[model samples]
Target: MSATYDVYIKKLTTQELGYRKGRLMTGGYFYISKSAVGSFFKELDKYVLNDFLRLDFNDPLEPGNIIQASYVYHNDKYAKENGTRNEYRIYHNRAIAKHQLHFQPYEIVVFIKDGDDNYRIEHYTRNDKAYRILENIIEDSKIRGQHALLQLSEYNTLLNV
Candidate 1:
């Protein structure tokens, strides 16, 4: 069977960000940001905005629904709390994404920024158990010394329209 996921873009309206304040991702809410948003847009069309939508929702997001809100936009603080310090050592440090729903076996990693003015990635799995499975991917990447390639899929927010 083939795996599938839900993906969409959320337009970042001037009303959302406003002239001075940028958007922020509240606890579980999706908010806009000033710094990283630009980059997010640049890569929005290639990466998975939300979670892996196709991972069967036996438990369901809500009480009866099969699909749950798996992923969401991450604010600076929340990202810092869940992510490693080294990963977000840049001027505007934050995790690009977060897994809000529970879906086993699948792991989601979102890289934001690094100290060397590079990039930082976030890893979000179905649960703690999947960490090991994801570790290998990370290890292999590190061992191969390959730079992670992130493309734009569909952003939860739309920057242009």
Candidate 2:
């Protein structure tokens, strides 16, 4: 079944850096760092403003889904023996020609549902890290058959959105 939700993005406060810190459109506040805000806007300008971003939420893991988001896998054996090394693997659908340039690992990816009812990767981080937290969250969401809502608190966990 298809679902619709009212999504809003807000800058988070520094004091509470752990929690998701946002309400369901009520009176609660969400906090994000100034640098994060700047990065988000910069991504927006590059992706949304340039019309490269689209939101197609048919099924993130489905092969038919045009947009695919994944993470770079760091093999422990390779890392320990050969020094740090990583490999990017597409988690959901296979990467097509259109998404070859954008779909990558170690980035904070934001998948949105566009006006045409298509899904796309909106935002992502540039740096690659050992821990693919976002990719894990997305995989968990697929397993649970629900949207992933990341909780950035002391006990960082993925909540169903």
Candidate 3:
């Protein structure tokens, strides 16, 4: 869709905060942060690498269309040995290929939590309003980049939802 918004608010992802150059992460798996995500993720087998929670997302970029993704939580012994925090990953190459949802280096992906197991995913460039806002937050609060959970909105309350 390649659309830019001076004020853009789309569906959310790993929602809030931002990711940087290494979003593709290791392998083709794309990851995000997990919060008070409710039963969908909460019930997932957190320590089981093979266990996954699924969601069907309505892509905001392409209205009225649904994209399916398989989400997995990594919090097992392997994760601890790797010194990684609890995180969520979506098998989204299908979404990327089918709907052109590419997360290039220094780009932004906003995952909006919709319901118990629903979300609105958004994409933006580093220079776009989304990235700039998160960038400012990162700079101002010294939030680490590249998959660091954005600890926003206690004092900030940046996005309405």
Candidate 4:
């Protein structure tokens, strides 16, 4: 049985502008200056909008950034994209049958900073369950011949031996 799931990105507007907790130094950073705060809000707005735009469409299984990695397992090999490789640690396990029945959702956070700092998009998996869900989603998609979207030449690279 095959099922479909929708992937969406939501806007996050809470800025963590605060204290440093340590043995000797306890300090707070405030967004007091109007210009600094205004500029920060503008960047946040753009970041959120970009995330929303990226989720406008549907994919059978979106492998997040893993699809860009060079994956080789057993007898299969998947070429890396953009000269980058993905590395992950499987902290827990879930039954593949149950995971296949329920698709997973991916949450990506984009941070924007200026001057010496630049913006970054961060991937967050809230829990081990969420991680399994996503792993199963990508696995199920591969089993159904959906790896073409990721440009993965073979399927064995993602299988658990």
Q: Please name the candidate that would achieve the greatest lDDT relative to the true structure.
A: 3
Worst 10 residues of 2 by lDDT: 41-50
Off by over 4 Å in 1: 1-60, 63-127, 142-161
Q: Where does candidate 3 stray beyond 4 Å?
A: 1-27, 34-43, 47-49, 75-87, 97-101, 140-161
Candidate 1: residue 6 Cα off by (Å): 12
Summed over model 3, clashes come to 8
Cα error, candidate 3, residue 51 (Å) = 1.7
RMSD of each: 17.0, 18.0, 9.0, 20.0
lDDT of each: 0.28, 0.32, 0.50, 0.23
Q: Write the per-residue lDDT of candidate 2 for residues 64-132, one digit (tens) a residue.
A: 555433222333434354444332222333342233233322234443334343544434344434125
Instruction: State the lDDT of candidate 1 residue by residue for 1-161, as single tens digits.
Output: 22221221121222222223534332222232222333431212112223122112222123433222222332333334454221111111112212423111224434432222233334344455544534543444422221222232422122121
lDDT of 3 by residue, 1-161 (tens): 22211221222332222333635333344554343223123446655654577777786668888777877766664434564546666765556445333545456555555555676666667666557765554456322334323322431366444
Report lDDT (Cα) of residue 45, candidate 1.
19
lDDT of 3: 0.50
- TM-scores, one per candidate: 0.20, 0.22, 0.57, 0.17
Model 4 weakest lDDT span, ten residues long: 88-97
